[model samples]
Target: MEAAISTLITEFKKYAGKDGSSSTLSKDEFQSLVSSQLSHFVKNASDPGTIDQLMGSLDENNDGELTFTEFWQLIGKVACQQGCFSQ
Candidate 1:
């Protein structure tokens, strides 16, 4: 579980940059990133429908994009649910 979370953080850094120093991800970018990285964990895996569902759930403002905060919140939630992060 720690390895999985670490892998996610690594991949996110690749796209979003370390500490999100790079440009923020647009909705499409977030979708692609999540699809590729979280494929194994997402219910429909790499399917577009699944990606859309995840975005809908995570994009709090309905802006169709996830800020770093939103992205991290989703990751933390998933990690906790999976027992990767203790409560």
Candidate 2:
């Protein structure tokens, strides 16, 4: 579990471009990162919509963006679900 968490953090850094030390991301940056890294999962979601829906659902503020915490919460929700990526 530790290794998995570490790998997850590393991947998030790769996407977030902050070495996993920060907890904020511009809305566009977060959307781009998630769409690319999580393509398989997002594509397989039950709704089958693009990453836009995922971002919109989590953006909360409707500012067309997401903070790091929001991004993590979205990813964590998917990761915590069984077979989310398998679709």
Highest lDDT scorer: 1
Q: Which sections of candidate 1 miss by over 4 Å?
A: 1-10, 16-22, 84-87
Q: Estimate each model's TM-score.
A: 0.64, 0.57
Backbone clash count, each prediction separately: 0, 0
User: Can you write out model 2's per-residue Cα lDDT over 1-87, one digit (the tens) per residue?
Assistant: 899778767766666564333445554556566666666666644333555677777887776656656776876677766455542
lDDT of 2 at 33: 68
Residue 42 in candidate 1, Cα distance off native in Å: 1.5
Q: Which window of 10 residues has the lowest lDDT sum in candidate 1?
A: 17-26
Model 2 residue-pair collision total: 0
Candidate 1 CA-lDDT value? 0.69
Q: Enumerate residue pairs that collide in model 1.
A: none
Local distance difference test, per candidate? 0.69, 0.63
- Which structure among the candidates has the greatest TM-score? 1
lDDT of 1 by residue, 1-81 (tens): 899778766666577643334545565677668777766555675677877887788878887667777788767776687
